[model samples]
Target: MKLSKGLLADLRLQPELQVPDAALLALPEKVLQFGTGVLLRGLPDFFIDKANKQGLFNGRVVVIKSTSKGDTGGFEKQDNLYTQCIRGIDGGRKVSEDIINASISRVLTATTQWEEVLSCATSKDMQLVISNTTEVGIAYVEESIHNNPPASYPGKLLAFLYRRYQHFNGSEESGMVIVPAELIVDNGTLLKATILQLAAYNQLPTDFITWLEQHNYFCNSLVDSIIPGAANIDTGYEDELLIMTEVYRLWAIETDSPRVKEVLSFAGADAGVVLAPDINVFRELKLRLLNGAHTLSCGLAHLAGIDTVKAAMANDSMAAYIEGVMLHEIVTAITDKHIRHDAAVRFAVAVLDRFRNPYIEHKWVSICANYTSKLKARVVPALLQYQQHTDHVPALMALGFAAHLLFMKSPAADDPFAAYYADLWTQHPAETVAEKSLSDSNVWGTNLNTAVPGLTKTVTNMLLALQREGVNAYLERVAAEIIIS
Candidate 1:
């Protein structure tokens, strides 16, 4: 049978499967969501569904399809009902469950239904606004909010807020909690700044601007979950909105406002929703341990002919190399006065476990996307910091660097870093590649050869060794060097 509100009572499902209460289906739509992507559906909508099932947050979501590429046929067909398949390893235990999510009440197209989307501005029940419009969606564009549908995300948001300001006569109680789940750092601050700039560009009234500044709560949020979206998975029923995600979830929201806390009372029902004055620790831990380790090891794993992260973890040498890099080098380097040593250690251990999860097929090639920027941002800082603290070269990091150079030998057309290195490889001699790469200040932000005493020599030697000995034999040698040192 197809999953929908009407089939909730008749369907005889397993005991582990959670069906939403019939009463909660009649709940008021209180959240104005900006995108229909799986990340928001699998994380925020999942949390909202959980809370509503427990009768804590009696609210539904009104989703706005911002883009015009896809129609709302699937949502309309399924009555906004979907299945969430949670499959992963959490706390050293395997987790597998399916949930019928009834969080979204309706999906409206922003371009055609602009007035309907704006109608929520006058709704007293609409208390929260959430968005997950990728990393590039928060930029300031010269757009007029008076357009039926503004061009940019921030512009669309300002138009909606302007409607609310006009509807309520700039009342304080009508303000909404705005939380953006974009991966950029300080997303809320940047988003609010962009909205203010757009308002000024449109010559908005001073009183409405003042109301926006004083009344609204823009909470900085960091969300962590791997939602790979619907794949070829049988759920014993038809579900067009099926989304697959890991069991481990986190939504860290930074806010100190009493009204904000009161409106987000759903935090009381689930441990995954954390409200704090700051979420720096969560951000740092994710960036340094999970993202950092991925950036460092992706090249090496791919060069070793490992396709998926779980496949790399299954190989003993590759797994050991990943563990040593995170636990010994990356974790130690990231732990400073602000981060506790024990906390970093715990996070690193958890990261290793997540890597070994059998259900998540994290592709190494996907991690290698934007390779140069990732190395500069995620790996290089740890490499430099490790040298500063220990005064000894990180053997695993050097091997990873060598693997990156070799991986970049065959460049993609769009990748400028790979193209530059590929050109250098064709023009320069083999022995000079490392020196030239280390000295390119434009790439590394500093002359790595001079910044770290022996990095050039170490990288050059490792590069030569990798070419002569191949990836597996070279990794074995790196493992032996770590053991010996």
Candidate 2:
């Protein structure tokens, strides 16, 4: 059978997918999730769905899409229904499909339902507010309260909190615990600060500020999952592609918010999510192991002419490049005990296995976008830490950085790196094409153009070779120079 809309409906109605209508739609209204993106569906929705099935949180999740560009017709068709496929990696084999279990209760485009969304924020039973609106979503805007429609994430949040403060008549119990999985350092604190900034800018009441500070709980969280939102099997069910992520999903909430732990019952030998004393440890591990390796591998994989991450992993040389970059370069730079040495190695090995999961078509583009932003998250920390501690740049991290620059300069068809670096090159456009285009210190942040030992020279030589030879030849040279050396 076809996994069409009708077929999916039948499947959801089946005993496994269907909890009693009462249980599924209990209207606890506790989960006010922002962003209808796949990560939220795959990560939080999966957990909430489990909690519902096991007679835990009776609340139905109400979703709000902060952006208007997401699916409208598809969400309208099924009353906001979709499927999440979980594919696990064990040894070298890919597991079977686990789909259709986690589906949305209601999808509200906040543009149309701003009032409804705000009302939920003030609802008596509402307790947990979750968001995944990308890193750029968080900001402070002055007109948050004055504007009929809020302009930014923090703006909308502040307005909601203000309303909730009024609705509760300053009751402390009505306050919520906000968890935003934006992969930002100090996400919760930054969000709170932005909200406060908005509050002050808008001249909101002191009572509201006091309520926000006193009652509300904003806990930082680190969420890691390879949720590549590209559906396979061409069902043509909706324009919104189904998402497949590794079964190794993890949620690390800060040591505080013990209530979140109790409410979710998230504890076990392999419970997947952990409540950590310092969420930063888990965050660093994710950045260095999962995200850093991914950033280091993307252009390399594309340069070697590979499509998906799995295919890249299948190619021995590409796989070796990934492993070597992690083991030699990136891992050497990590400072945290939880994320350094053996721990980093174990995580890197797991990430490799995740990369090779055949069931999940982890698209290069999924890991490819926000290259600059991702570098900040993953590589820059290690660079700063290692430089600060050792007082010398590590070789592997430098090599990975050089490799990123080299691929960016390559002018090859089917070159993913070309498009990635197009903007930077277009702005700079290597003067004379003979002298290595990116000699500009701006791109490298420092005079890394000349400062980092023989990096500029090495990268320039590789770029020249690529122009003359090809990606394969360039890879051979890099593999010999960086990987072998």
Best candidate (score: lDDT): 1
* Cα lDDT listed for each candidate: 0.87, 0.67
Give each prediction's root-mean-square deviation over alpha carbons: 1.9, 5.2
lDDT of 2 at 177: 83
* TM-score, cand. 2: 0.78
Alpha carbon deviation, residue 483, candidate 2 (Å): 10
Worst 10 residues of 2 by lDDT: 429-438
- Superposition TM-score, candidate 1 onto the true structure: 0.95
lDDT by residue (tens digit), candidate 2, 1-485: 53434555456555534323333544466678888777888887777766666666656678877766755566666555455666768566766554553336677776777888787766677787889887338776567474555867787777778888888887878777888888778888889888888888888788888888888888788888878776674433443536676777887777555565655442332366677668776766777877888886776676667888889888767777777777766677774555657877777777778887876666675565655456655776676666566666565555455456555554442444456466555655343231343354444354443444554455555555555677666566566765557
Winning model by TM-score? 1
The deviation in Å at residue 21 for candidate 2 is 7.7
**Pairs of residues at least 3 apart in sequence or in different chains that clash in candidate 2:** 329-396, 329-397
